[model samples]
Target: MRRIEKNSLGAALMMALLCSCSGRTTSEPFVQSVSLTRPIALNRETSHLYSGIVKAAHEVSLGFKTAGQIARIHVSEGDYVQQGQLLAELDDADYQLAVDALQIQYDQLKDEVERTKQLFNQKSVSANDFEKASAGLRQLGVQLQANRNKLDYTKLYAPTNGYIQTVNFSPAEMVDAGTALFTLLDVSRLEVEVSIPANEYLRRDQFTGFTCRAAGLKNGVQLRLGSITPKADGNQLYHLTLAFAGQPDRRLTAGMNVEVGITVADTTRTGGFGVPPGAVFLDGEVPCVWVFGADSTIERRPVALREMDNEGRVVVIDGLTGGERIVRAGVSALEEGEKVRVVETPSQTNAGGLL
Candidate 1:
């Protein structure tokens, strides 16, 4: 019975040794695979593109200076008019009759004033009598001139070169004085409008140049800064206006859509760097990136961000110098000081690393 018990114990020991070997084989540490990229070096000059719209430099509402019935309208909506060109006319029969009556009275008053002056020279009239006659003649002359001006005001003329956008009244319609008769879009000059964020608004002084691209424009049109609104809108965006540096294309008109490009000069002594946004993660409210070291390990590094560019790359103002390889994929699952294997991009001919 003692010999049988010894054999059973040996069998139990062999089974325990096999289980321990299996455990040892499956206890290896996990090494994560990740992709890496190098941060791009930024230059002192950076360019950004934004959607903008073309607008007329001035929108003018043309109206008559005197109240009258519109006799005729010479121009229609969408018609191009030039400065001093007659656009509309009012019924001027009443104004003309008033001017004729004033002229007749002025002529009679002039004759009386001349005779009184002659009498004063001959000492046949008192000084007060001569003065009264001269004053009456001057008052009548002023009245005649005012009536003539009113007659001229019966016609509406284009104050500037522009295209008529709207005709508010029809022929023979009675319009009050200073009532808008035509809406003119002044195209003598063109402007481009764009909305920018507060960050760009604060750095507006750093903008060095501006250009715009539109449909059918092979080359971009240069622009000059015109004005910026002091207050921000509900979207927290400031309205910026830019005028053409020179004369714009003849085909370009108001209400056309365009893309504006702005070039800004970097004022920082240490230039900024560009990195993919995914590589940057938040660490306790601080922006951080996983920088891969020569030892095949990652170190969490804090960085100062300025703003994202049009290409969606974050501009790093501090913490990274440039040309540093960083983990670009699966950054959230990474831990500090952990060893990782870099994932190599497969060549086009050897896709999936099948070879």
Candidate 2:
């Protein structure tokens, strides 16, 4: 009976040993399907940001110099006019009649003065009589000149070349002296006025490379800084003036709201690897990137990021060395030290080429 017991114990021991070996050998590798790329080096990435519209520089208001009843309106709102061009005509009939009357009186006074002078020269009239005739001529001439000016004022002319924005008085409307006849905008040159907060002005050099964009500019257009106003606004906003690179099309007009972006600085670093924005996942507050090893093993490494560019790529600032294989796609489904099959997509190949 003792011999039988020993044989049973030996069999049990052999079975247990085989089971342990099988357990160790049958365990599968943690296979994770992913895409990978080398980590980019610094000095190979650029930073980009966005901002709002800047208006053109020069603007003026056109007002009537003299008061009169509007007889005709020569131009309407949005009409372009040249300097000294007639903008409107008042009730010039009365003014013309007054001028005509003054001309007639002046002519008569001149004739009388000429006759008086002749008489005085021939001793047919006293010096006092000749002086009276001369004085009458001078007084009439002054009055006639005043009347002529009133007539000329009846016509409204543009002070400068610009687009007419507002026409306050319509035909037959009584406009008073110095009334606003038109609001002209000089769009020949436009200025983009932006108010940068005090904090932004601290880096005064950042204002150098900004671009201004309106509704239609998707590709982005460049803007040049015209001036930085020294004084702040009521809210302590520093006003910045940016001039357009070239004359914008007529479609761009004054008072049109736009988006502007000031280039803070050139942060294009070299040898830095970029990944699709989707691939960047946060492990707590720390930025962590996944890299695939040569044997399809995944390793999670911390990375420093500088800024995101306009192209939707995140810049790998540091904590990553160049030419290190990193998981480019399917980063969200990765675990530390997991075995991954690096599936090279067309985009992934292109990204590899870029580095």
Candidate 3:
């Protein structure tokens, strides 16, 4: 009777183990339905960043034509001046006196020359006498014109319409000829001067290769390959100018540093589906993903991926089609042929909802 009881107990234990195993198998996720799409190609572009400075395309340094003491400044720094507008005046008292004196002397000489010419024509004066008068009158005329020019130089006018960047001289300050009085700049167009490293400059072809790469870049800024200044030294660097897409109304000063990015190249494919970057797995250098196949079965399929964007989505260039389900959320722990239960939930989309 004891032996029979022991046998019955052993049988019960084995049955219990079998029941537990059956229950576990029933609860396992068979296959999770995943929405899939046909593989499409998406072009991705990248860029190289460099630093530069913003400078006015048009700039003028105002200076006096002659040396003199400043009498007045009509415009201050940051003031807008028009072409031919008086910006300042030098002390003109002495200049005016010189001009006035020369004018009087010129008038008197002119009268004498006219009188001498009349006498010579009538034969009343010697030819030598008329010639002497003519010489003196001509000399005086030249002196008078010089004095007028000197007087005009005393008042400074803007050479071009622009904003005053700096005031180099103040009222009563003595300045020599060619000494800067004001710095003016036209902000209608701005240029960014970027210095490219020598090695990168030699690869100038790369700059032009990326024109399509900038299509979707931010700030509506576009770049074009400008003149590359002569290469100098073993460390040759070229200066690249960045032109803005539109004129900026905001004020820009000289020497403002900026970051310049140039696209190099891009690879694109179209009409395919993409998967979350997290869903991609590496199987011995092969790109694979756990996909919920039809008939409630999970299988890991090899796929080709390209970095679609910076937003953590990989373009499935190949190996996937629309209407197929793939494990997106719980893909990391999933194995090949592993059964999965896909909870039907809202699918996550790119932030803009457009791939």
Q: For model 3, give the 10-residue run with minimal summed lDDT.
A: 209-218
The order by descending TM-score is 1, 3, 2
For each candidate in turn, the TM-score is 0.69, 0.59, 0.61
Return the candidate ranking by lDDT, descending: 1, 2, 3
Alpha-carbon RMSD, each predicted model: 8.6, 8.9, 7.7
Query: Which residue runs of candidate 2 sit more than 4 Å off their true CA positions?
Result: 1-51, 54-59, 78-85, 112-143, 160-163, 218-220, 229-236, 266-355
Pitting candidate 1 against candidate 3, the one with the higher lDDT is: 1
Highest TM-score model number: 1
Clash pairs, model 1 backbone = none
- TM-score for candidate 2, please give it: 0.59
Whose lDDT is greatest here? 1
Please identify model 1 stretches exceeding 4 Å from their true place.
1-41, 268-355
Residues 124-170, candidate 2, lDDT per residue (tens digit)? 99999998889888988898888888888888787777888787767
Tens digit per residue, CA lDDT, model 3, 217-262: 3443454554567656455667776666555325444566556777
